[model samples]
Target: MTTPTVAVGALGGTIASTSSSADGSEVVPTLTAELLVAAVPGLDEVAAVRAETLARLPSPSLDEPTILRTLQWAQAAVDEGATGVVVTQGTDTLEEAAYLLDLFWDRPEPLVVTGAMRSPAAAGADGPANLLTAVRCAAAEGSRERGVLVAFDDEVHQARWVAKTDSMSTSAFRSPVFGPIGRCVEAEVVYGVPADRIPPLKLLPGHAGGDPRVPLLATYLGDDGFIVDSIRADDVDGLVVAGFGAGHVSASMAEAIGRLARQVPVVFASRTGSGPTGRAMYGYPGSEIDLVARGAVGAGWLSPVKARLLLWALSLGGPVPRADVAAAFELRGRP
Candidate 1:
């Protein structure tokens, strides 16, 4: 019933960038806690706002420990009476990071992640505006109902559905099939279709001291098992086959997946990135139908990176129980 206080946590990305002091030749990211606060003067008008500079790394440089620490800090902030938490991160791997947090987050408090497409070098860099709206969304009562989210381009997206669609556009973030779940309205938030809100971030580091490589191979119309077999014989730790629509694969490709499953685990994700994979979704001989029956895990509506990250964490050998890993997809009826 009390007024909510929102906290913004800054991780390095384009949001925290600046031009070179002397030459102005390069726009390097130099976003510190102080500078982020300086960029958003409206924080004083909203609920108690505190900005903490947790990391100064690029988005592509984001790793499990950093994400874990960010989740921990956000959880602590909400526990300290803040209504929610906002994270400013690099856009490179934001989708993957957000999905990781969504599956593992264990609380009900609002958690919004956002970033900018252009660095400080660009004229209309969208960092400050995005950060301000992320804070407002995190504090909005409607936001708490959606779990971990990404607030960008004036739109609120579920961490699960958001993917970067472009490199140079401010509209890089998008949810292709389902569209945005919410958006910012002045100082408030508005909801669209209700997102599958999950528990707060309760993640255990599944990739600590483990290999982070997730080689993805997609099967084409005339594809053979050549590429798949190569990855199996290489230094890769896991495999994510982006099968054709409905998760269908070629007979040779399905055989390759089965072979890789024997050496290391192989998971199948769809190139469509929407529906869950169905081994026999298309009745084709090489359809993912055979892959699932061969002990390969099927990613339900999760894109390749999310599937790869989940598999990477699983391969570390000390992750949550096997049944628990299997349970991660139980919501989609994984057998």
Candidate 2:
């Protein structure tokens, strides 16, 4: 059989970074996609690889337009007969980037996103191993139709559920609600639990119009909703609230949320690291039930960032109906 072709695109991160100072102190992304691919051992035996440097910015500097460009690149790669695709970027924003790609990646071939927690200058840097496993996962037959995946530490997680849970660990990325859906063992891919695949959002013509302003706010103790009240409905296209446990917030914030929901879409998600937002458990003034009654939608399992992305994507085609936004949350927010 012909070797499967995998296209690797580099969006510079720790995986492609090295020490920029003579003292070996500060590290910066300096390697190209071809250089990263060349460092991997036994990668040639797995698949025929095509490498390209899409961008050289740190993950934090990566914006929505860059991600959309990468998405288009991946689609074009698939059209060019590449069996799969691997995206290398900084781990800092890997989860968010992967999810953003997942939202519009309407393809059967796997698009795996991977990044290194440690820079190439660090002891035992993990870029090569992570990239190899990501390629293996991308080449795996089972990975098809699985949507965009975050491959890290030999584990494969669905983009919708994965998040960066730690700041300085090789195992920082995790699918908190459910563990990884698959793992690469001995250069072979093994899938454990099956993940539900949500249909990719359709991008209408001129979908790249203006950047939508959707801010994410987290509730805390004694929060008086001053920040929420300060945001004018005319300024923002949508809002996402990372509410207290099970999607509850201060009574004052809930009132402000209700008022804002009347003007624009408001999505509430759990602030806790794991678990879905409560739908109807509590009935208090600031409970999920109360928020729903006030027109805010519950982001069942989506994190605040992901919820914000969804709201932003929805509003890109102009003002989305509140019911339509709620329906989107109901579908994509579920596990």
Candidate 3:
């Protein structure tokens, strides 16, 4: 069989980080994509690896333009005959990045995103293993048409459902809603379930001109909606509210949300981290039903962060129609 060509793009994270001091106190991203690929044992036997250093900053510092550029690079690589693509970045924002890519990645070739919770300098570092697995997934035919995937700890998760659940565990990433779609065993890729693929969002002309600001607000006990009230319609392109238990907020917060929905798009998601936001469950003044009645949209199953990214992507061209925004959520927020 012909060897599959996989392009690996490195965005500095724990996988590429090393100690800045001799004492090894602070770890910073210092390794390039070529260096990371070279360090992985038996990687050359799997596929022909092409490496490129897209950025040297931590995942938190990676901006939208950089991600968009990476997307463009991946598309170009596929066009130039690469079988698959892999991205390495920090776990802190890896889920969000993979989701954002999934929203617009139209190609059938798999684009796998992976990262390490532990730095390469640390004992039991998992970068090389994760990288190898991610490459294996990318090179596998089973990964085709899966949209974007997150490969971590031998488990393969769909980008839409994967989340960074733990702060400092090698097995931090998880697909809370549907579990992993696949896994790597003995250097072989096995897929248990196929992920549902939503239609990719098309960018409008001149999408690169400006940045859309979409803020995510999490509601808590005794919250009075002061923060929601403070946001003016002109201040942001969209708003995502992480409400309590299946999307409920205080009465004051609901009122503020209602007011904001009249001016700008508002989406409410669950703060519990899993499951879909209630569509017609409660009917109180501050319930999901009330919020939807007030012109706010429910983010059925998308996490708050992912909801924020969706809203931002929708608003990138300009003001998105309320119906269009709702339609997007209807497709993406479902299981």
Give candidate 3's TM-score. 0.98
Model 3 regions lying over 4 Å from their true place:
none
Model 1 regions more than 4 Å off: 1-3, 21-25, 199-214, 220-222, 230-237, 273-276, 313-327, 330-335
Q: What is the TM-score of each candidate against the true structure?
A: 0.86, 0.98, 0.98
Tens digits of per-residue lDDT for model 1 on 1-335? Answer: 56668888888888787776565546666878667767776876666777788988888888876787787788898889888888888899999888777766777778889988877556787887888788888777777667789999889988877899888889899986778988787767789776465443334555333455667777789887888887743576667888888777888888877877766667778887566677455555576667766667778777777777676655555433435545665553231
RMSD of each: 3.3, 1.1, 1.1
Provide the overall lDDT of each model, using Cα atoms, as 2-decimal numbers: 0.75, 0.92, 0.92
Candidate 3 total steric clashes: 0
Deviation in Å, model 1, residue 197 alpha carbon? 2.4
For residues 22-131, write the lDDT of model 3, one tens digit per residue.
87758999999999999999999999999999998888998776788888899999999999999999889999999989988989999999999888878899999999
> What are the runs in model 2 whose C-alpha is more than 4 Å off?
194-196
Show how many residue pairs clash in every candidate, following the order shown.
11, 0, 0
